[model samples]
Target: MNILSLGRSLASFIVVYGGIDLVAVHAFAPLRSLSADGLPRRRLTSRFSAGVDLKQNEDLQKYFQAAEERSLAQFARDDAPAWLQTIASLPFECTACGKCCKTIGSVYLSSEETWQAAELMNISSTEFIEAYASDIIRDSAEASNTWVRLKEKEVLKGTDHSPACIFLNSDTNQCQIYEARPTQCRTYPFWPNLLASPDAWDAEVRRMDHDSESTLLEWTPDAGGCEGMMILDQNSTTLGVPMKDVYRQLREYRQQDRYFPTGDKKADTER
Candidate 1:
């Protein structure tokens, strides 16, 4: 039975790798409830699922993308919907499948995040901007804080690839300014918090879900620490636990003050 019909929240179950104690990281609110006749019914819009309000405007894209990543990571858990309850009970763990980070698309950086990245390199923001940040219209439909950094740049000479990010230390394959990295980068592999609609979600799911003989299975991790693997682990299953409330809590959690890569008190956090 579709858990949505039974008034259950759809959650993504996740298993972290490298021998960490399993803790339930992300979950959603129940979407349906059981009926008296032993069947499930969809919760009404007024009280059922929180309607997803997708933002397509370019100005909001990065912020939206960050949110989408967090949300999708939350949903990618093995405990998320579609997986049976039995699978949910199993102690799942990520295998460090770095497929999520390699060959990744653009990772947007906010003004504050950009500045912090510069500091990590012990360079001024001006220098960093000259080296990396470029004003580009990522989306014409909206006025986003659009900036692009190259990762995996095709060498002008022999076939060598490098990332656009100055903070990426080649030997370590890690972000030098991870504490201050952009929210989008922090929340890789799961981007639905930025792209809201289920339809958009369906597209991403189709893009990432590995099938036999799929080229995606051959992918590699972009960096060390396997942080994004956490995201991939989140997306790996469909346990369909209720996650709306969980997301709200996470959003609230982001409000607390913390040191970022660029500097302190760099972001408003409310956004």
Candidate 2:
């Protein structure tokens, strides 16, 4: 389908299956970031429904590629924060050991995320929210806002049940709905806290290992130890696009006012 058709289809699917209002879709449309080439970015916004398979859509993939480049350029800025600079200089590769999936705290879900996940699961949005999420109050810079977080399941070993993400498969140590996972899950190692410094990253790795009962894996400043993990440099890497860039692009979607409930001034008071 053409870009306009794709956008319309996504918008219609959300309204029809996800039960989102059209007005909300229009409000979110303007948040699409401009590509580095000065073209508008084609992103899957809040209006996107769960049924569209992004993997099969080549145009969508190109859009994602453009968006990734835009995110990477941000890190090259002279005024980039220290944390971002630290991350840019380091090489990170997900071992796919599922340690983060098993150990990290709750995965918060936005309203858009809830709907998309529900559609991916072939269930109603209300059903998905009811089954997987719980309400929590989050204190933001402005005020406390109510949000939903994905519920955790207990990893049973004999008699004890340890906390783990509900979507994590204990037997395989992988995410069940990885493709539809929330943005929080998608941006794993690049989290601001972990990128604070080398020591902070080491601390986070240690915590993940401890929580998931995995062997202690040390982080080497050089790219030598891990087999599956790729050493990301500006050149000479054949591991496709680096995950750091992909995660940053995914993160950009959340850094917009449209992602949150800005219309509800009472619930989300501006500072």
* Model 2 whole-model lDDT (C-alpha atoms): 0.51
Worst 10-residue lDDT window for candidate 2 reads 262-271
lDDT of 1 by residue, 1-271 (tens): 3435222222211111122211312111111221221111222222222432113223332433455556545544532333322222211233334333343345445455566577677999778777775443243343443344434434456644533344455565566666565654443322333224333333333223445554332232332222222122334434332243333322322421122233223223211
lDDT of 2 by residue, 7-80 (tens): 86556555643575433432332233333432223344332434554557766556546654554465445323
lDDT of 2 at 11: 60
Overall local distance difference test of candidate 1: 0.36
Which of the numbered candidates is closest to the native, going by highest lDDT?
2
Runs in model 2 deviating more than 4 A are 1-71, 83-89, 136-146, 155-161, 206-271
Off by over 4 Å in 1: 1-101, 136-166, 193-216, 220-271
Query: Per-prediction TM-score, please?
Result: 0.38, 0.54
